[model samples]
Target: MKNTILIGACLLFAQQLVKAQSSSYKPVEGKIMTEWAAQVTPENVHREYPRPQMTRENWVNLNGLWNYAIRSKGQAVPTSYDGEILVPFAVESALSGVGKTVGKDNELWYNTTFSTPKKSRNDKVILHFGASDWETEVFVNGQSVGKHKGGYDPFDFDITDHLKSGKSQSLQVRVWDPSDEGPQPRGKQVNNPHGIWYTPVTGIWQTVWLETVPEVYISGLRNASDIKSKRILVTPEVAGIVDGQQVKVSAWKDGNMIAEQTVNPAEMAKLTIKDAELWAPGNPVLYDLKVELLDGKKVVDAVGSYAALREISMAADENGIQRMMLNGEFLFQYGPLDQGWFPDGLYTAPSHEALVFDIQKTQDMGFNMIRKHVKVEPATWYHACDKMGMLVWQDMPSGDMGNGWEMKVGVLGNQSDRDRTPESEAIFREEWKEVMDDFYNFPSIVVWVPFNEAWGQFKTKEITEWTMTHDPSRLVNSASGGNFEMEGTKITGDIIDLHNYPDAKMPDPEIFGKDNILVLGEYGGLGLPVDGHVWQQKDNWGYQSFKNQDELYARYAGLIEHLGKLVEAGLSAAIYTQTTDVEVETNGLMTYDRKVIKFDVSKMKSLHSPLYNK
Candidate 1:
């Protein structure tokens, strides 16, 4: 049996080191530097736009450098600053300019100075953290104002009271991440980085900024598309507002208004377009939209955002095989295994454009789908996939496989694969539900994969059924690989799936449901690109790496063509190894930095065109 307790500690280290910057970003081996290096400077650390859903000309970019130091587990802030670190990257990340680690016995601390916008006396200021891993405690101007948990979701704190009012202010963050130490939604991270597991991010891994809102402001917004009705439902999260307040929604395309509607906050606000344009990978037409709160007649508060009209489902092919359907047609969903990591940003892409490039390359490769494996992406990622017509199969990030070869994936693999204390089994089941609820709102996501190779899997029948009941619209993959047998066939499975690597073998047609799509959950990790472009200079590898771009292109062309032959065998979709190089994993079609494409774009797209009709 594998010592999972040791594995948990290793997961945390994996996340920090996975930033994988070879030369300038090397770790200090065993030395522990708690303070972030002050070289990059906080003012220039992360200077990009915070929100991509909507744009406003007046907002400020609060990403840059900050003073950081890692304190002992129960210690307070250090008396002196050791160095400067990048604001957004965690202290453990080399890109953070800190290149440090705060192990299980430490707390990462960050502090920055900022001046408020010259606002009137009535305005209120609110600070937001795009995301923070594990547990976080926030303080403003020395006063402990708020704190939060949950690594993958966004949260905020109103620092108005803790502010210096008219003077320059200080904001501070104290964070503690146990990684696999506790029952949180951590994806493939271990203390000892090896094989599939990588380093852990122990602090603010996403953007940290502030936005000023009216005393009575719009707290949040939820947008859902009703494809059958050709309409949408918009709900506002408003504070200090009456229940019957009215709000207006306006749809804009390229700075022009195409549709408009007004409604009481009681029911869904419906808007229609005479000549409607829906979003897909090829066209990716997005209509810019904004919503404003109306107090009787005056515009009180507003927020900017956009959405597309799209639908995903399972449909029957002519031969009665269940197939994955997009917009009501069985288009074999083919694309790369997108791990969503970066040479610099890790979970956070270097820039928004860098994030979009991965999806663009997959589309260029003629794939309309991406299996976002064991990771939840930033909001902009799904927006790009939705616009690019790329469908997404989102997996709930699971943790630590249990003891023994069979328990390794936990109730997966051959021989029932189940081995774990009932205590651990109960924890795994609850965590799965929490992950689904956190990401249930994404429109581009069509499938929920609960267990992949049985990693930490157990009681799948109850879990899969729970997922179906929680979100019935999407398809579910009960167990991705390992231990899939004839007896436990009802263990919460909908689509029949199989895992392949480097090469894809066809699925058996008769065994697949005429209603459940036949899917190759993983395949085609063919690799090879030039030097410098490689994440690692000597040790880089793939399931099969090539010598040149032409050869790589030829192999991918031949690989997909083979899957095309399996289309008649009830096959509806397939996912390749990955979208980019992650840590020691080099199976991505593109390098980690997004600098080069291993295959010719036009040629790859042309080759992929046949899978749709196949």
Candidate 2:
């Protein structure tokens, strides 16, 4: 009877809290919003599991609404919040319901109350954030639990010790982001919005949740596939291992067990299948993974995961020109420069369906790859790419501008490198390493781009070599479309990439053909803005604008024809300017609202089909 009464009281308190949060809240009115915006509500905001790579069943979503206050940077927690903001959305975003700015001089504060799930003594309550911008500090019951830096990476803290012996507990978070002021990696976000730059994203911009796990559980998994040997190397990182604890990994194809292995906690487990189905674009084959943490014969913990068996390598073609080979087959890669930004949510997508919509549309357009331009997406985006069979080239978000940059397209140019301060270099290195480590498990990532257009290029050889040695499984493009720093007339990385505007152009084959793979990293920023679907009525622009769909299609077709000629001249891959119109830059195939595809879908698909033939 007493337990029932306590539960009732907790339910009543939660209801009153929800009422208080929504009574004074209103979503910010933005000029453009996607169709999914109307479907958004605090009760249903980003309810999907944020992390698809590693998932557990016993988890509580702490999304919904939370009390928020913006205060001076060094101020204490406010006695009362200013208003309620939607979780997983930035405060400056229209979807967050609190379109306010929190600069370096100010801090964004969030407060909420959650009930602790009933758990055994050996269970640990893990608080997870899919991502938060810049610096974040967490407190539980007024006790500081932990702090994390880096805006693009997911982090967690074990708050089991801070939870009092009660049905409810208080949670607080403080965040600070300097945006373009600091030398951190913030891509295209400035204090002021303009062309190619958008509004700043501050505070919690991804899902926040709580999960329970056993004291001794699986921390992480790294799987690498060797297509030649038909074997998968699995390195499982386990925490709190004791004697008699074993890690078991089972791989399944079409719900049938293909291979299984058991190994000790720290040892690497190799699962060999007799005939592994290779993963490739247009025919994505993934094997289901079941991992178990066993104490003797009893299963203490189990997780659902997945993997793909594929390999990416660079080799000289029949003409002695370098090309990219996927599963030992030379396939021409072509796709768009996908800046993962939303019209309403900035860094965060409105919903999981909306997130998957872009990838699906790209696939429907018959593209094979995507160069994720200067932003890391949620794990679910990568997971969707894995399942849908789209290749990826991940870029580290560029920052610390005003470096001495050189743009040389035809000649082998050596530009003066940026002399970043020690602190700036450390910040870049640490965050780059974290980004790589966090997204290393995804099979769709074929290349890592550390610098773009020399935006933050420094210590070129050192950074490129570090990235190569760090992950030898994938190729590296040292500086995509940046000045080619030569070491005795040889480019440093695997691909010699170039950039051109509104036309398909590649590096001079005679100059770069023998040494490195030629690629047009970015081109064709053809724009067509639709009425009622633009971020602003005036001042919207693209590399080249068209008045009608017919004109856009004709020009786009001509670019593809030119691109095909480059393919014959040893060009390997190319990335179009962008996937969607972001902010005032109307260069995307789709409008900012995502309500219209500017070109005919069937014709676009047909035009892109010939690029893959070579």
In candidate 2 the C-alpha lDDT for residue 430 amounts to 92
> What is residue 480's positional error in candidate 2, in angstroms?
1.1
Please give the CA lDDT of all the candidate structures: 0.69, 0.88
lDDT of 2 at 103: 85
**Which structure among the candidates has the greatest TM-score?**
2
Global fold similarity of model 1 (TM-score): 0.84
Candidate 2 lDDT for residue 12:
100
Task: Give one digit per residue, the lDDT tens place, for model 2 in 1-614.
Answer: 99999999999999998777665555689558888988888878888887777778999999988899999989998899998889989999988998888888999999999997779998999999988988999999999999998889899999989999888999999999999998888988899999998899998988899989999999888887888888877788888898889999988888899899999987888889777889999889888888898998999898878777899988888888888889988899999999999988889998999999999999999899999999999998999999999999999998888765556544333466788999889989998998899999899999999998888789988999899999999989998886666765457888888887988888777767778888889999999887788899999999999998889889999999999998988999999988999999888989877999987888889988988887
* Candidate 1 lDDT over residue span 203-241, tens digit each: 887778777777877766656666676765566567677
Q: Pick the candidate with the highest lDDT.
A: 2
